[model samples]
Target: MRRMIFRRELKSNARGLVIWSLVLGGLVLMMMSVYPSFAEDAQTAEEMLNVFPEPLAKVFGMDTLNLGTYTGFYGVEVHLINTLVGSVYAALLAAGMLAKEENDHTAEFLLSKPVTRIEVTGQKLAAVLTNLFMLNAVIAAVSFACTGFADEAVELDILVWYLLATFLLHVTVASVSFLLSAVMRRTRSIVSLALGIVFLSYALHIMAGLSDRFDFLRHVSLFSFTDAAAIVENGGLDAPCAAVMVLVSLLCALGAIGYYHNKDITG
Candidate 1:
């Protein structure tokens, strides 16, 4: 039954997965295509960036903007924006998965089946994770292809680490949103709540960048640990931070499973 439900979910969400992958890939290609032009005027670009207000510059990672290096350019230009888009897609997809059945008045029929709620939640969660992995895989391939076009030699290790950290961040956000789906009665409400959480985290991250007083907020925002500049500079993910993210994701998934096990299903 779990396999049956998992297969059904994969089939149902296939269109969305493809659409999101294409959208992300297209944006990455467009951004990377301009890398060569920036590389040509690296010094000029760095000087120009220096003129911007320090706070404003830091918000976009311009403080560390190094057009001279491909990784540096990508850290500033592509990573932040890509993270935002990918996180939103992940949150929305997870929030809608189980909640859609309720919002569309199909939950009654679904619950009428012989399958248990645990099976339903477990299978659906598995499907969400699978979709996220597939989405990241496509984006990673596109990013690498674009990088190859923009540079002669790429830092394969740093790129792989960045992708891995980004994937973990996505999974954390998706798990939280999935829990929200189980808790909220309406799909619209779940989406609004989930997006609000992502935006708040992003805003907190930017605010943390703007001043030292808000640096404490970084501990709360997943974006802080997944910062591209920091990731690329450090050469890999921070072990403690990555562990915390994984723990949070696990707790959220457990909460969702527990809640769904006892949730009332009505049309």
Candidate 2:
């Protein structure tokens, strides 16, 4: 039953997986295609960035990273889009996984099978992890390929670390949405809620960069944990941020399983 459920979930969500992977990869390709033009006028670009308000520049990672270098340019541009849109993808995917069974009036059919709620939840969670893994894997491969074609020298090791941090970010956000799916009432569209969560977290991350008063938001926002600028500069995720991402994912996933196990399901 577990195997069946896992396979079914994967099959049902396969199109979404493909679409998201293509969208993300396409964006990376489109953006990297412009790197040559930008690199030629890197000095002018840096000068233009400097004219922006200090806080605004800091919020977008123009504060510490040089736009001329590929790594810095990637951190400020490609990586930011990757994390932001990737997080939204994670949230929306997770929000629908289990809850859609109920929202689609298929919960009763699933529950009638020779399967326990635990099996259903566990299988669905497994599917979510697999989907996220595949998406990130595609993104990483595309990113590496793009970097290879660029004229600038990029640190492959740092790119690997950045990709890993992005995977962690996706998992953290997915876990949270998975829990919400387990607890929220059946609904056809949880899209708004999922998008709200991602944007709010992004806002917090921006605030953390913009003001010392909100500096603590750095710890609260998953975006901060996976900051492209920081990853490019430090060569990897910080110990504390990695720990927090792992801890949050674990806690939320466990909570989702627990709550979903006993919650009543209706057609």
Candidate 3:
């Protein structure tokens, strides 16, 4: 029964997983392909970028990373897309995972079986983690391949840390969305609210960069945990931020399990 539920969720989510992976991979490939040209006149590019306002530079992480290096350019370009777009995918995947059962009027049928609510929750959460893991796997492979094609001796340690941060970012956001899925009855608001979290977190990150007054907002933004420039500079994630990610993800997932066990499914 557990295997059945897990497989069913995976099968249902397969199409979305493939579509998201392809979209993210395509973007990474396109950005990395032009790195050679972008690196040719790096000084000119840096000077051109400098002419822009300081706040704008901070927002894009231009202040910390040099335009001349591969990782720096990647931090500004590809990293942003990976975290932002990937978070959207993560939020939607998790937000819909459990709620869709009720929205599709399949909850009654599912619960009618011998499965306990705990089993159902466990199996569904497993499916969510599996999907998130697979999505990151595909993106990481594509990123590494693109790096190879660019023929640059990039810092593998930094890249590894960046990928780790990306995965953690997805897990953290998805866990929160998973908790929301347990509370919501319909799929409509689940999606809207999930995307809202992603965009709002991004807005907070930008605000933090745009002024000193909002610097504390960095601690509240998941995007800050995955900041490419900071990752490159430190050679890894910030211990405190990473701990928060782990702690938040765990609490939200456990909360989802608890709430879902008592949730009154309409269907």
Candidate 4:
């Protein structure tokens, strides 16, 4: 039953995923056109680095330095933008994926199955993950192609680690959305709440960089740990910070499971 529900959900969503894949592909291509030049010479790399706001780097994982290599350029544009934006965008999409049906009362035929709600919710999340991974794979392919013309060898270890961290960030966002849907009554409210959390946290992260007054906001938003520059330089996870994110994500996932378990089937 869970499998049946998941298949239906994925089939329904296939078109949107295809559209998003194209949009992301375009973003990657646009970045590729300019990024290669940015790292083509020492002067270009230095200039590219300088254009980024110093404090803002902390919020986007810009602390890493690839030291004038393809990895460095990839980190600057592709990984960085996706780190800040992709994670949340994917989450918003996932959060309302299943819950929206319920909120709209379109889930009746599906939920009427003999399967338990947990199975349904869990399988739906799995489907979301599968879709998200496909998107990530598309993005990664473009990135690898862009970074292929390297003056220096590829840093596979570090690049993979950072991308993993970025993907985990998306998973966390999906969990948060799922948790929200379980409690929020209206789908409109759910969308606003999901997007609000992502955008608000992002705005706060930026504010934290610009003002000391909002400095404390750094601890709360996931974007604070997404510093692409830092990841590229280190080529791996920020152990302590990554752990904190995992814990928070676990809590959100658990909350969603618990809430759904007890939630009345009103939708």
Candidate 5:
């Protein structure tokens, strides 16, 4: 049962991965254009770091861009921009994925198979994980080329840690989207809410970062965990934020499973 569902998910996501790879490759090429200018400036990496807004640059992973005497450009392009773009893309993709089947009335056929609901859910998750990894792999490859062009030996350790932060954020988004699928009656509603939530969370995080008065708002927004700068240089997920992600995802997964289990398949 698991095998069958997994295969179905893989087949569905294959095209998505391909399209994403092309887009990600193009973005990498574009960001890489900044490297020559960043490298040639007589300014030290620390000085370049001083120019961007503290809130803005931290959001873009400026803290980790400073690796060696000559290796900060990679952090700005790969860690900062990649985290922001990747989180939104992954959220949208996940939000539409499962709910579309229910929206199309195809869930009847898919669930009618001999497989149990648990196996079906597992397969869907497997497909989600595969898609997530493939997208990151695309970015990693293209970013490799960018790093190479910078004429500095890149630090693989920081890159991998930043990717891990990305992975956690991706899974958290997928779980929320899946829960919304379980809650909402229509695919259009799911997509709208998912995208809206992503942007809303981001705005709240930015606002919270700008003023200590708004810091309380940060706890309610998931974008707090999307801090690539802290993850890349600090080599750890922020403990409190990480806890929030884990708690939210686990609760959402449980809610989704229970919702679908009791849901009237015919309705």
Candidate 6:
């Protein structure tokens, strides 16, 4: 029964998963392809970035612009977009998985089966993790392959760490969205609220960079914890930030399980 539920969820969500993976992978490839051209006239590109106001530069992650190298250019150009898109994909997938059952008026029938709520939640969560894992794996492979387009050799170690941090960040966001899905009764509300949380977190990250007055917001925004510039400069995963993501993901999963196990699902 557990395997059946897992396979069913995976099959149901496969098309959406494949579409997101291709979209994200194509975006990463397109962005990485532009790196060689920028590297050719790195100084001019850097000077162009210098014309922006300091706060604006910081908000766009141009404060540490170094286009001469692959890692630096990727950090500036590709990382944030990749993070944003990947996080949104994760949130949407997680929220939709459970909530759709309720919204489509299928939950009553599903729950009437021999499956317990815990089993349903566990199977669905497994499917969510599997889809997230597949999405990240595809995009990471695309990003790694696209590095070959750069003039200089990219640092494989830092690239690996950056990708790992990005994956963890997606997991954290997806777990939170999953928790919301378990609590919310409507699919539309779940997706809307999930996206709202993502954009708000991103806004906080931008605000944190804009001024020290909002520096404290960094602690709350997941974006700050996964800052690409910081990851590239540090040359490894941020241990404290990674730990926080893992902790939050675990807690959210536990909360989702508890709530879903007790909730009344009626059509």
Number of the top-ranking candidate, with lDDT as the measure: 3
Q: Rate the local accuracy (lDDT) of all candidates.
A: 0.86, 0.85, 0.89, 0.71, 0.70, 0.87
- Which tens-of-lDDT digit does each residue in 1-267 have in candidate 5? 649778877787788778876877778778776667666663675575678777666555564455332235555555555666777777777776667777788888988788776666666766777888888887777766666666656666766666666667777887898888776778788888987887788888778776668878767877667565555556666788888888888898788777777776652
The count of residue-pair clashes in candidate 5 stands at 2
What is the Cα-based TM-score of model 4? 0.87
- Write candidate 4's Cα lDDT for 1-267 as tens digits: 649878977897788778877787678778767755555676756766677787765444445555366666566666657666676567667768657877778666666779887887787777877888887787777767766655577787766765787777777777788788776767777878888888877787778766678888778877766656556555567777688878877897778778877877665
**Model 6 lDDT per residue over 147-247, tens place:** 88876767888788778888998999999999999999888889999999999999999999999899999899999888877787677878898999999
Rate residue 174 of model 6 by lDDT: 95
Best by TM-score: 3
Scored by lDDT, model 2 comes in at 0.85
What lDDT would candidate 1 get against the real structure? 0.86
Clashes of each: 0, 0, 0, 12, 2, 0
lDDT of 4 at 189: 78
In model 4, the runs with Cα more than 4 Å from the true position are 44-67, 211-215, 233-235
* lDDT by residue for model 2 (1-267), tens: 759999988898899899999999999888877777778888888888878999878888898777776667777878888889999889988897788888889889998899988888888999999999999989988888887556778777777877888899999999989988998865445667877889999999999999888989988888998887787667688889999889989999999999988898876
The runs of at least 3 residues in candidate 3 whose Cα sits more than 4 Å from the true structure, single-residue gaps closed, are none
Residue-level lDDT tens digits of model 3 in 199-229? 9999999999999999999988999878987
Give the winner by lDDT: 3 or 6: 3
Candidates' RMSD to native:
1.5, 1.7, 1.2, 2.6, 3.0, 1.3
Clashes (candidate 1)? 0
Q: Write the per-residue lDDT of candidate 1 for residues 1-267, one digit (tens) a residue.
A: 548889998998899999999998888888888889878888887888788899878777777647667777777888876788999989988998788888899888887889888888899999999999999998899888877655557777877887898899999999999999988878898999999999999999999989989989889989998988678667788888899999999999999999988988767
- Evaluation by lDDT, superior candidate among 4 and 6: 6
- For TM-score, candidate 3 versus 4, the one ahead is 3
Give the C-alpha miss distance for residue 47 in model 3, angstroms.
1.5
Misplaced by over 4 Å in model 2 are: none
Off by over 4 Å in 6: none
